[model samples]
Target chain A: MSSMVHHFPILLVAIPILAAAITMMLRSKPKLQTGFSVLASFSLVPISFILLMNVWNSGIQVYEVGEWGKYGIMLVADLLSAGMVMLSSFVSFLSLIYSLDYIEKRSLSTYHPLFNLLIAGLHGSFLTGDIFNLFVFFEVLLLSSCGLVVALEKDGVTKSTDKLEATFKYLVLNMLGSILMLIAVASLYATTGTLNMADISVKLSAMQAAGNLPWHVFAIGLLFIVVFGNKAAIFPLHYWLPDVHPTAPSPISAMLSGVLIKVGVYGMLRVFFFIFTDLHDMFQPIIIVLALLTIGIGAVSAVAQTDVKRLLAYSSVSQIGYVFLGIGFGSLGAIAASLVYLVNHAIAKSLLFLTSGGIIHHAGTRDMNKMGGMVNSSPFMATAFLIGSMSIAGLPPMGGFISKFTLFDAGIMGQYYKEITIALLFAIFSLFYMFRAWLLMFWGEKRDVKRYGEYSEHSISPMIYMPIMILALMVLILGVYAEPLLSIAQATAVQILNPQAYIDTVLTRVVR
Target chain B: MNNTLLSLTISILFGIGTFLILRRDIVKVIIGLSILSHAVNLLIVSVGAFSGKDVPIITHDEVASTNTIFIDSLINGIFAPMLNGTNPTQYVDPLVQALVLTAIVISLATTAMIIILAYRIHEEYGTTDIHKLKRLWG
Candidate 1:
């Protein structure tokens, strides 16, 4: 109803780019740059919440860039996209705040700018309606994330070369994934005649209804699995994540694990559910089967990990599997469950990673065996870590428990009994690995000075732990007061199932 | 016939790129990435080539080629002129060129960054071998 609301989609991306540029310019004054970037990042929270509220109130909002209509790039913020943007902006803001104290002081000049660019990329990828623009934002995400991984000053546990190794692996694999994405996008364009997603959706449906859909169109749908699968770090394409995620500085690690890989999940949802709706029957089984393996492999590898960060990274792989499992079910209740699962995982996982940063900083080691009973060293971090673990492990009184229950419940409702059975088994795996890591790090005898060497002793800063506390509190509130989130996710799932509303809103009737 | 030729060439480049990526040398892999990206760029251009009118690059004849799939639109061309519903005779699909240009720029930045990363990696690890660079893989 309002013209200003029409501009929110583009503003969501543009504000971050403006913030990055301004943050880069203010680099000479460290305090000003930090304050400005933090303020800018925090400002996105209300804007995205407003965007989400608007979409909920008045259907989908589409912003046509350059007024090119259906022919040029567009930004469509549907319930799914709006909710994802809201989640990323909230997580990025908290991560940026956590970064202020955690990142090395000398590197602050480069850190804030790169971090803002990363946020911009995440928002843009979630918000863009043009398929090619999705590719461009993905590149933005890749480069900025690699830069942060390879260039930042890491804690002692991750060596200089370790970051390099991780970045190289991440870059090469993503490069391969990007090429596949181009092939898919181009071929789809060749067949469909449009890059605009809504326009393409209309054309694609028309083609299928005409009973003349091309074979290559089906191939492109599957090819998207590799592209978004690589981004999400699911099975078969998940090789780079464990190595890459843990080697970055802690705040960056939180972003990677928390929201970045979920980009792939977003891509899958957007491309498959929105544009390729006719092919749902073909893709449903494939996605469910692969998602099951992802859960198994991630849980197994997570159990075997001793490095605290690496364990969390592997656990993320498993958690993402659960989210995908819900997605693969393809029911309204199931998709809603996935959205609920995704939000909980993003919050809980980011909290855990940030807490791990403090733990690593406190214990001066990443190896869990080397970190002994540190509960007394920092009671605040101990409590923070416990809350994050409780939430991620899907224990009662945490957000993850609600999501896990909803997902499994939805799967059962959809008559996916075997899949639910396997998933329930892995849910136990998550509980095991999470509590095991926490106990090994927090409850054992103190770090042995003679056996493992002396740890650097310093007071954990409030700047570091405060963000973790906020996120932890969010997890608690989500678990206790779950109605608002459940209703929102339900609305998002309904929007996802009904693609016509999205197409009609994005491709205005004026075109015909 | 020309579509077959371009598709053949793109597939060959893809094969070469895939092979190079399997090599042990890191620089070779970066080269592999560049070639693979170029192959994708060519694939995009070829997609347009499939839909394009017979411009000077493909032919100089007065009438456009009839073999391409897009010619079906010409059945109602006088009424709609729907090559993307735009004028086909004036130009081939320019959107592909725009898309290719964007892809090229992105791949350029990515390739350059990767090369610098390979160099920094060589400096840090004293090896250009990707296999030897698995320290983070525990």
Candidate 2:
């Protein structure tokens, strides 16, 4: 068991790659592929949980690929990485099952493989100790998601032209971001002569202590905002997300909203908290300003959106702003609040997306104006979406409330009064937009059947509803009993803010 | 002088790439991406830690013998091989080269994906102009 624990860090990434390859081979047998993909994705939940437990029990777990120690690529699993892996795996497992019924049969052949590969990329990006390896994993994530976005769906409701255009924008912007990342990474390597993140942290701090740290290193640190900001879809960089997330098939939308954008937050946390701790004072104001802008833009744009999916996509942008706000606060409580906010948003947003899929399917349109009084027809979807929207609106008795409360509490505790006030103002925007969207869809007069066509009376498959219900239940449970999640998030925050544990583990490894 | 020239060249390539990407033509944008990648790759190589002419590779025989004179004289007076066995700074840094190789492969794969996507976009819209492709505006 102990030996197996050592291998968990690599296996967390490897299992998905191996499964993707196998799933590709079973393309002729999609049923078998579906079963296999479900099995593989669900298996990740336990593996990630066990890995998290191991990290909690022991210190950081470092696995050097090819036994090159710090000289080679290393996979490091700390509390935060393991916790994220656990969250991603759980969300992915549910999304995969939802995809079984949600994705068209024709697309399943490539969808399963691409989805697994994306998971592999996500795990790899989170666990890798080498910054360059993180870049590689980012590419893996980018290309696979590009493929998934253009994949064909059953009803062909989402036009291929739109998918292609959104993907084009996504690719072009992200590719530019990648180039910036490469330049920053290359420059950092030139300055530090090391690629291992832990080694860089140690070397950089030592350099700072000696008063010889160069100015460009700070530029490189800022460059990360472009790299990860592009990923997380913050403020100016968030244009592609509202286009792309809404255009993808629903399960893919769930995965994108649930886990993919969080990758940016993870990168920001890892790089800022661990690698660039000395520059916190310099970075704090910049991050705070960006966070406020992100919240404002996402909320205002969401109000103007008529497309249900696009509205949710814009809301994702707003929620990510709150997470960044917590991060910019740079306190133990603030980081924990951010983590809690992140987890709740992951659950609620994915639930909302999956339910929106069902709603769109039933209504035969993506426009909220075309969808009215859905509770008269698909009550289950209406209820599920209500739960999700209420949670997202930060209403009481939902997980979103707890997260928002904690975030605002910590913001006050840290005494960022003006920023928190502005954030709270935008939080009202969140409430207004979310409730407006909900009221527009579920409470109004049923759209004249003669014009928009009658809502589909056909019952939704359990495969679709089951995942939504599960996530909805989780949102309720998390809100009602927030202790365990909060504690874990607190622990993860402690691990991130203090990098000594990570540095010691990665640097002291025996070279094979 | 060489460093300044290289930096100037990289900046020019980056400027050109940015300009092309801003154009309406999809093919031009892809060309811009390729050019940008080349610039980045060059930037990595130029940042290599050593100015020595010798390759980074060291033979097992060289490791076993530890004859400083034999190894030091192989390269010219630009940089001498440090035989102290404590640091290997004399040889060119191999890590950046390896990273550049990975970056190249990644950019290659991305370029291919983007090109195919462009072709598909062109097929779908019957035009490569990005302005005409705005069906998803808020």
Candidate 3:
């Protein structure tokens, strides 16, 4: 059993994809398809945990596909990748469970398959060691998400036309990102003569040491900002997110807000910290500026949102900026803080989005103005939203507080006063927007059932509540008991700061 | 001169693609995206297309005292004697071919998807104009 552990990384990706195929085959059997999806989704949590523990105890695990060594695709399950997979799997599992009840019957036909493939993509993106494979997984993510977004929901708020428009915008924009990514990657290959990220790093550094590194190599590195920034929804490339997020069903909204954008930050960290560490000094100022703009724009725009989902989507935009700021600082503490911030926000924001699903369920509309006195009818949802909002607002006893505090503390300790000050101000704006949306829906006059119709009894299903409650519990737990996560984050930050460990592990794979 | 011309051609395609995408027409946008992807594809080919290098073509040459063995990367790829141990170097062309092939496949899938989406969007919104497809206002 322990010997089978090496296969966990490939299994993590393969299981979901296989399950997606199985789910598609069982399309006529809805119950069976859903059963398989739930089983697959639930199974990943344990697999990811064991993978994480394996990496923790045994160090980084490298799986070279088909035993072609570095010549073939490799999935490097380092602490960072393992930990990220665990986070994504956990949230996606919960979100998958939530979708069981939230998705309309008509859409459920393709939901499980797409959702499974999406998880497969996420796992693959987190695990793959090759840059080209990263691009493949990203396209997988894009298509799966586009397929999911195009479907209608039970909420009745999303029109088919809206889905079409959002999807068109998403596909077009991401198509541009894809082209840019290929250009960057192809150029990198041209300059360094390799697609394996570790090999590229070694070659680039060797060239640098030999005093003849091409400047276009750095230009290629900078182009990745556009590529990943598009994926992560950072400023200037974030337009597709707000439009796309609100039009999708609620659980998918959670997945998009919670985990998908983080992939961008992950890509940035991978490229800059691990591959382009030399690019860090030059990239920092530019990223910090872009991140600040993202924060300011996202926060400012979030404040003006009438749709609860749109507000959360914009908040995703803003929150990703903070994560980028952590990346931009390029210090061990800051990166660690960013990891901490990322985990907290992913949990809390997913919780809020799930709670919004419940809210949208109860209120019968996504418009916050249409909602009032939700607390009286759905006390459970009220409590959940309160917890999610408080956490996001950086209030104590919720995970967001710890992450936000650590982020600012790291920034201040790094003497990034100017950057942190601006970040802090946006943080306050986030606080206001988060709670204002909360209070407007949960605290005002009694809901007008006569106009908006009755609350959806569908909101109260175990499938929905189970994920929400678990995520809420996780948010609280992350706040109250952060030592384990913090230690892991610290270790990950160290691994990231020192890329030699990763490169050595990858390059030294014995050919079979 | 060829490299310069190739570079100019790629830049021109990029510019044209960028311009077309900015048009209000959704079909134009899709075409723009296609052009951009093709431009990048050509750029990749250009990156590998340095003049006077041994353009590696499939030949079942001697490799490791074997003549008929296939290279692992491709199903029918011949083991190039010049590519492995005896050769002190690696050519960028083969890698570039693989990358461009993957990119082409991906772009094909996405372009098909975007076209389907554009058709659906037109069906629903009654226009291919992106300006008219603004049902999702923030």
Candidate 4:
């Protein structure tokens, strides 16, 4: 069992890639492919949980890929990486199950393989200690998502033109981000002569201690803001998100909004807290200003949207702002608050997007104005949406409130009074837009049949509804029993702030 | 002086890439991306170049003797110092070469995907102009 622990990190990434290849071979038979994908995705949840528990019991687990020691590529799983892997696995498993029924048969042939590859990419990025390897996985994520975004659907309601345009914009901006990342990585290596993240952190801190750190190193640190800021879709870089996310199929939308953007947040945390710890004071004010603008823009734009999924996409942007705000506070308690916010938003936002799929199926339109009195038809969906909205709005007895409360508490503790006030004002913007979108869809009179056509008589599938209900239940459970998650997040925060354990583990481990 | 020249060329490439990406034509944007990736790959290679003229491959005789010498030196209270008096022109840094290889492969995959996507976008929208492709906005 102890020996098995060494292989767990690789297995978390390898299983998905192997399953993706097998899924491609079985593509002609959609049923077999779906079963295999579900099994693969479902199995990841336990594996990730076990990995997290292993990391918890023993400190950072470093798996060097070719036994070249720190000179070769490594996969390091500390509390933060392990915790995020668990969260991503849970969300992905549910989303895969939902995709089984929600995604069209024509698309499923390619969807299963692409979805698994996306999971592989996400896991690889989280676990990799090599900065260059992270870039590789990011491209895997970008290409797979691009293919999935334009995949053909049964209803064909989402136009190919819109998908193409969205993909183009997403591709252009992310490519630019990748270029910036490569330049930064290259320059850092030139200065420090290392690629392993832990090694770089150690060398950088040494340089700082000696008071010989070059000014270009500081510039490299700021360049990372563009690399990850584009990924997280903050403020000015967020324009592509509201367009790209809603244009993808709903299940993919759930994945994108729920977990994908968090990759950016994870990158920010890793690079800023670990690699650039010397410049924390310098970067904090800049991050605070950008986060506030992100919240304001996302909230303000969400209010003007009439499309259901588009509104949710914009809301994701605003919620992400709060996470960045917590990070910008640059304290142990504040980072833990950000982690908690990340987990809650992942559950609640995915739930909302999944439910929106069912709603769109019933109404035959994406416009909220075309949807009213939906509760009279599907009370289950109404309840699910209401829970998701309430949670996102920071109402009591929901996970969002706990996350928001802690973030505010951490901000106040950190004495970021002005920034917290602006964030608080935007929180109201979130409430108004979320509830307004919810009421516009579920309350008042149903749209006239003469104009928008009759609501479809086809009932919502159990496969689709089950995931939404489970996620909604998770939201409630998280709110009521927030202790365990909070403790895990706090542990993750401690691990992130102190890079000594990570560096020691990665550098000192004997090559086998 | 070589380092200065390399940095200047990289900056010029970046400027051209950025200028091209802002154009209306989608194909031009793809070209710009390719150019940017090439520049980045060059930058990676430049970062790895030390004052060396030989490949990084170490012969077996050198490896064995160095291993024994390193152990002996450690035991004799003398640290193993390869870079102090050794000829700097013998070998280049191998790690960044490995990094560049991986970067090139990744960029190749991404560039191919983007080109295919650009072609598809042209097919779907019947135009390659980015400004005309705006059906989705707030």
| lDDT tens per residue, model 3, A50-89 | 9999999989999989987776799999999999999999
Model 2, C-alpha of A463: deviation from truth (Å): 1.2
- Among these predictions, the greatest lDDT belongs to 2
Which should have the higher lDDT, number 2 or number 3?
A: 2
lDDT by residue (tens digit), candidate 2, A67-101? 87777799999988998899999999998888888
Model-by-model DockQ, in order: 0.47, 0.45, 0.46, 0.50
Q: What is the C-alpha lDDT of each candidate?
A: 0.86, 0.89, 0.87, 0.87
Error at A239, model 2, angstroms = 0.9
lDDT of 4 at A349: 97
Per-residue accuracy of model 1 over B1-138 as CA lDDT, tens digit each: 888898899999999999999999998999888999999999999876445455524342422433321232313423112433345554566778888899999999999989989999999989998778867673
Better of 1 and 4 by TM-score: 4
Model 3 clash pairs are: none
Off by over 4 Å in 2: B58-89
DockQ of 3: 0.46
Residues B1-138 of candidate 2: C-alpha lDDT, one tens digit per residue? 889999899999999998998898999999999999999999998888657655767677776676432222212322222443534555666767888899989999999999999888878889988778879783
Provide the TM-score for each candidate, comma-separated.
0.94, 0.96, 0.94, 0.96
Off by over 4 Å in 4: B68-89
**Mind giving the per-residue lDDT tens digits that candidate 4 earns over A1-512?**
88987898899899899999999999888889888999999989999999999999988898889986776789999999999899999999999888888778888899999999999999999999988889889988888888888876555667888988888789889988998999999988888777888878877777788787889987997899888999999987999999998888888899999999999999999899988877777888888889999999999999999999999999999999999999999899999999999999999999999988888887888999888988888898899999999999999799999999999999999888999999999999999999998898999888766776667788777888889989999999999999999999989998888888888899786642
Clashing pairs in 1: A373-A444
Cα lDDT of candidate 2 equals: 0.89
Native contact recovery (fnat) for each candidate is 0.73, 0.71, 0.75, 0.66
**Stretches > 4 Å off in candidate 1:** A451-455, A509-512, B49-90
